[model samples]
Target: MKLLKTAAVFICLTATGCSSLNHEPSSSSPSTRSAASSEKSWWPFGGKKTAPETAAKIDEAATHAWLDAYEPRLREALKDSKFTLERRDNVLIVTAPVDSSFNPDRPGMLMPTTLGPFSRVAKLVEGDSKTGVLVLGHADTSGQAPVNRQLSQERAQAVAAIFRLSGLRRDRLLLKGVGSDMPRAANDSREGRALNRRVEIVLTPQHTLMALLAQYNTPAKAGPVLAVTQTK
Candidate 1:
């Protein structure tokens, strides 16, 4: 009887220990679980993901005002050269005749007189960090297509180089050669061909001004509204 009682006591103690082990609380706290959940949500391949940057908005009114102030100065500076300045919206377009700007003897070399006007333009634009410049070269349809394209590109590059030398930032200048593809006039007559052969310099507002405008001019989102008709 004593041996049986001892055995029964030992079995009861073993059962109680197993029950206590099963009822023990989890080791992780609420804060620890939250940290783990946050990591899982943000991490991809063990690296945290970041949101992309939003682009800046352009202020049309400010841009146009800037161009308006810029046009007369550019026109006065290039009065002596065979260049014409026209303002369109937020952009100032300066058109230079290739015959007058470049030398006939040297393919892509600019004329000495042309240098003064271009330098003056560079001086005017270089001071304004809000503006960007584009130099486009155009050729008449007189030469072979490939040759004309290459000539136009070289001329555009030469103009950009002059701007860079005259204190303009290289990053702000864009150069392109359109060849005979973008003729201002018909290529059938001599006068028309002369008009076709030209270099166009375009200046407009850059990122900083545009971004400032964007912050203030964001359009408000419209919400749905129910309309009720009145019966008389």
Candidate 2:
């Protein structure tokens, strides 16, 4: 299944004109590019320039490699649960229904079954020191904003405590409770409300060798520069 998915991704990238082997000439000299990069904002990944085509391929390949190592283990661990796992903007997002987390409207009491899933999540985070955890609690629009907000905050704290006990470092954990402000679905329907009342645990790298993979894959602000205007 992994191989099939990978092949499909390759095909999709090719169809969308994102082939790794494609090449384009640089518009400016190395020295000129260097000067421009210096004036740009600083990043941990530094401002080293590579040909756009090559950089795109590197970015795509690196991201694929990363998923290969991370996603499968998570899938195996949480196969029995009705949770959602996905990667977005260079982070792994795991969402669990609030029902699975604790008793209805009870933030202080964590359900016993929730411990296994939380442990698995902790193991994943523990294996990678570069990664950080962000736990966000959300709710449906069933009550006053302030009440919901406090409830969400309490739930987030409870979950973060479990993660810390499960072996994640305290400094690497971030907690937030947005309440009903960020809903996954419309709260009018039962199904939507269920989806909206959830917790999103995000695992992201604090620092990595290629932290700018997304940026490298992005198109330059100047587009494919056909001409470089020189100042006298």
Candidate 3:
């Protein structure tokens, strides 16, 4: 009887040990559960992550087409002046000499004559809700860096104010002051320095407008439509 009882106890202990080894615990610690979940969520073979919806692609062809249509109109509006218009990629850049746009005595203030051209530009762009206007002020390297930057900023602001007063949407206008950083000519000569002192009005199409243009310009059989790459 004693032998049998000892045998039975040993059997029970062995069975309990085997059961524990065969089955995991019913519940795990929070950290262990979280780690397992993370491991299951990751996949090494998955492709690159998608870009955000706001990261639209620009249609180059559409942009160029839009520029083609507006370039002549802009040139006509700014005719017979110190202002020169050029097409750089999709942007229409209207470059105006500082002498024509700003008062010599007050570098930050706009010349009275500058109003007509600026107003004309404002009127042209105001009707197009899909265009954005950038007023950029450039200064020669004659003054202190801080002073030049401030003057440039003020001039840009002055130009932007004119656009606003002429009924351009406030949200569509931006201003920047580049003081002697992007010179059009060598700054060592008087003529070169004069050339560098200028303001540029940059006109760019918004992404929504570009997309529409792409669809309109692209042939139906030309594979996928051009994607909008960037917003205004």
What TM-score would every model get versus the actual structure?
A: 0.64, 0.61, 0.65
Please give the TM-score that candidate 1 achieves against the real structure: 0.64
Q: Which portions of model 1 show Cα errors greater than 4 Å?
A: 1-57, 208-232
Largest lDDT belongs to which candidate? 3
Query: Which tens-of-lDDT digit does each residue in 1-232 have in candidate 1?
Result: 6545533433343223222112113442323422332122111112222212444445667866886778788888888677888765446778889888777876576666576687789878898887877676678999976667657756766676656655776445655555676677788999999998888787767553222222212223111101101000
Instruction: Give Cα distance to truth, residue 41, candidate 3, Å.
Output: 39
Considering TM-score, where higher is better, how would the candidates rank from best to worst?
A: 3, 1, 2
Greater-TM-score candidate between 1 and 2: 1
User: Which pairs clash inside model 1?
Assistant: none
lDDT of 3 by residue, 1-232 (tens): 6545533433343223222111223453323422332122111112321212343567778877888888888888888777888776557778888876776776666665566777788888998887877666678889876566546655666666656655776556655555665677788999988988888787888553322223212233222111212322
The list of candidate 2 runs beyond 4 A from truth reads 1-64, 208-232
lDDT for each residue of candidate 2 in 1-232, tens digit (9 for 90 to 100): 6545533443343233322221213453323433343233112112333322322222445545665678777777777876778765445678888887766654545665566676677777876786666676687889876667656655666666656555676545655555676677778999988887888776655442223322322334222111111100
In model 2, which residue pairs have backbone atoms overlapping below 3 Å?
A: none
Candidate 1 vs candidate 3: which has greater lDDT?
3
User: In candidate 2, residue 30 scores what lDDT?
Assistant: 29
Off by over 4 Å in 3: 1-55, 208-232
| Superposition error at 158 for model 2 (Å) | 1.5
